[model samples]
Target: MDTKQLNYYAEQDKILIATDCIIFGFDNQSIKLLVFKRRIAPFAGKWSLIGSFVKKDESVKNAAKRVLTDITGLENVFMKQLKVYGSVDRDPGDRCITVGQYALIRIEDQDIELVEKHGAVWYDLDKMPDLVLDHNQLVEDALVQLRLKASYQPIGFELLPEKFTIPSLQKLYESIYQKQFDNRNFRKKIIALDILTKLEEKDKTSSKKGAYLYKFNRKKYDKLADAGINFKL
Candidate 1:
């Protein structure tokens, strides 16, 4: 490292970079978001998205992953960058820029102890409370992105259990899109996709005539994708 280069870098302005995660989980009925109270002075004890400052040694994606793991104790969950928010006055406490990443995880897969330890609570999408800073905007953007992605990609499987019934899957899609789909059409469309394997085991908890469980076949979906077949739902 040359002294001239070191001097040039030292003269540059320093700004804080952060990553905020909008975690969406499905619990068989509706989609929910994970939020916790902000511990900082500017908005202490207010509802806020799970977030962390990007460390000097870590990328923004890793920072988001770290925050997610700290709260949910899960790894390799489906996550994607939604947007970067850099409004000059978005944060009153400091000149900070946040990269928003949204993640989908099965609600049953997370470690409850870790979630509680971090003071996090899952809130229904429709009844979410006011959040700190621009988190509300982030949530709105994430929901839009989620619906868009789910329509063309088989990403909704990330929010479901290993095996789920067709009715349960329909409910999941309805919850995401906030619309009711014709049962026959949904079932037909999903079956035509040929990405689900019907199992003999029945989930009898919902009814006496139980619905048969189905598991998503990721390999089949991947192969179809590689063959240029589109998944539409």
Candidate 2:
């Protein structure tokens, strides 16, 4: 490699660091993000990103997982850093580098009561309240990254229930896509993906005209993905 490229890598190796997780949860109808209520902050009681300083003992990703488990009492959720927000005035407290991560988690699977104990709550992405620091920017970047990844991966299903209605699936897409989608085209695309299997029954609780339920066929999606095929709806 060229010496200039080598120098760039060398400088990257010595950057300041921290971790922030934008935990996204699917609540039947919407995509939610996890935010921590700041206990000690210039903006106390106001919503802020879930975060931690990058300690000498753990890598950035591991520190993120640790924060998730410690705060939410949960583990093994899909965690990946989306971007590093390091504007000089981004944080009012001190000079800290915050790397944001987007996580996919099933809301029903978590212990909500315990989560609240840590001052953590799920914020509806559709109407997020004012956030402290550069948290608003973090959410913006995370959503874009998630949409790009979802187009290629079955990650849209990651936050969904095992059995879901087509409307619910469409709602999930609209939540991420942030726009209205034609029902006919959306349904056609979902079926054409062929990774969703129609369940034996329908979810009749919502309406008299029950919507058919479906589940992600991970096995088929995995095999197809392994063959370099992409699934998008």
Candidate 3:
């Protein structure tokens, strides 16, 4: 490489790169989002997605993972890249661009103390508060991507426990679609997928009859998934 070629790239205007995470969690009955009060000057005290500027030596994905771990104290969670936001005045402090990423987590698995220590709060998606910058749009975009992915894949499993009741699974689907599903039809459709194994145990917490507990058969699910099985609810 020649010095002139290197200088050519250096002459271009510099802009800051950042990554924002739209962390979604499901409590088996409803979907929730994690937001925090900004601790910096530009939007101090305002609600904002967990985010940070991309470091010079790190990949954007790593930056997002770092931010998620820092804020939620959870690691090894899979994150999906939603889109990039680069509106000229998106950040009041400087010229910047941000990549949006979303991750689905089981609500009970999170470290509540760590989240609260960082001033983060989990808000039900339907009742989310006003957010800073274009965070609201970021969240909306994440939801669209989530819904699309959930229709074609078994991504909802990430939001649930190892063993769950049929009603719990139905509630999860209903929460994702933001509507009620016909119980009988929903059960028939899900059972037809053949991805779950009914356990002998039953959850008696909700009713006298008790619903059977089922575990996702990952081996079978993977085989079917590889065969292009559609997991639409």
Best by lDDT: 1
TM-score of candidate 3 against the unseen true structure: 0.94
Clashing pairs in 1: none
- Per-model CA lDDT versus the true structure: 0.94, 0.84, 0.91
Where is model 3 more than 4 Å wrong at Cα?
Answer: 1-8
Q: Rank the models by lDDT, top first.
A: 1, 3, 2
Stretches > 4 Å off in candidate 2? 1-16
Which of candidates 2 and 3 reaches a greater lDDT? 3
Write the residue-wise lDDT of candidate 2 on 82-144 in tens digits.
987888777777777888988888888888788978878787886777888888888889999
Residue pairs clashing, model 3: none
Clash tally for model 1: 0
Global fold similarity of model 2 (TM-score): 0.87
Looking at model 1, residue 50 earns an lDDT score of 93
Superposed model 1: Cα runs more than 4 Å off: 1-5
Best by TM-score: 1
- Tens-digit lDDT track for model 3 on 128-228? 99999999999999999988898998888888888899999999888888889999999999999999999999999889989999999889999998999
